[model samples]
Target: MITDTIEKLVAKATQLVHLFNYCELCEQPIYQQVALCDHCVSLIPRFQLDSLSGDLLNRPEIYGLYSKCVFDHLIAISPYQYPMSDWLKQFKYLGRWQYQRLCCRVLNFHLNELLKLSDFCPPDIVMPVPIHINRWQHRGFNQTLPLARTVAKVFKVHCNADCLVRQNQTGSQAQASGQLRRKQLKNNFALLPNETSYETSNEVTGKRVKLEGMHVALVDDVVTTGATVSEISRLLKAANVAKVSVYCLALSL
Candidate 1:
């Protein structure tokens, strides 16, 4: 009986260590495993697609003045405003890995609602926007990978990080203008070897995977000019992916 009691105490201690009880923003004790407390969550600006102009939804060719390319749909959890912007900076730049759970929960909730829409369909595969090996080594993680995996789990779909490979060590896109970002990212990604066979291989054969009828969702942390996702969507389309959708945690508006 004492051994069982000790084990129970140890398990509880572990749970407490992992549990997030305080709001990331205000540092107040919260009841749930969320990053932000209820007040902060409500204060953050959410992207309401329904309230936006129909042109933003139906047109697809242009989001404001920025021209979108091959991606057919765009879904963002929140606008790049206020606390969200701060949260993203902490999560990505400052390496607050715990923030991922909160971000994923928000994205997953929004994605579920999106899937209910008449024209929307769940993707066959979910992929994180790949980072170059050198970049990943520097960061110790691809920020989008966790978000993508969480989303894939929610949708019950495959999350294939290897399906898309970033070949170039292009520097940060954060400071670049839209045109420059596009120019830099062009031809930076390629399909993984033996992608179609669903097998992992190290050989970098020139043979491309045939995504003939598959719908793919590209996951990223943020969308600024739509340049990065657009370039990736172009490549996916070139490889015969039937549809490409871009999902981001926030959109810079």
Candidate 2:
């Protein structure tokens, strides 16, 4: 009985350690698994929840920017700014693995809240916008993969990285104007042949999975000019995907 009591105490102590962490922003001891403490989390800028909907194009700010969009919907946690941008750069360029875990947890929590309050339809499949093989080799990872997997877990859908692919390596669009970005992004993406076979929830073993009529959540780390995702969305549309929803960590206005 005494040994059992000791083991139970040790387990509870370990559980507490896992549950609490120092807030990334404020360094306060936060009593949750999320990296940011409540105070710091509140300080992160967010779109007014009241204005969000199934189609973000309904918002004047977003609509004015994307007057016409190929993708059916958009969901994002914050505008591209401050700590979010810093976190992404650190994880993508510098490869701070902790930031990857931080980002996944933060985005997962934000998406959970959004789903609870909105009538948004969960997607049939989750797909991370693919990077060129060359870049993948250089970077050793696709920065969006972890975020995409998190979304797939939340929606309980297949995360297919093999279907859509970045065909050409283009120069950075960071400094380019929207018009230039769009021009450069044209034909930048292509889909794998539909004949490709895979294991999927809707199909039997050894059968091919068709994207036709499936709703896809295209996950990305950020949306700057929206060129990359828009181009990818067009490709998915050509594949007969019934819907394509853009989900990203941040949006640059």
Give the 10-residue window scoring lowest on summed lDDT in candidate 2: 194-203
Residue 88, candidate 2: how far off, in angstroms?
Answer: 1.1
- Cα lDDT tens digits for candidate 1, 1-253: 9999999999998887677488777898776676666676656678665443211434344354455456777777787876678777878888887777667767766666665666556777788998889888998899999889877877776678877888898887788998898899889888875664342233645444456778888999998888888888988888778998788888785
TM-score for candidate 1, residues paired by index: 0.77
Q: What lDDT tens digits, residue by residue, belong to model 2 across residues 1-253? A: 9999999999999998888889877898887767776577667776655356645676887877876668878887888888788889999999899888777877877777667766667888899999989999999999999999999988877888887788788867678898897888899888888532346665465566778888889999998777888888998888788898999988888
- Taking all chains together, each candidate's TM-score versus the true structure is 0.77, 0.86
lDDT, candidate 1, equals 0.75
* lDDT assessment of candidate 2: 0.81
How good is model 2 by TM-score? 0.86
Off by over 4 Å in 1: 1-43, 50-56, 59-64, 197-210
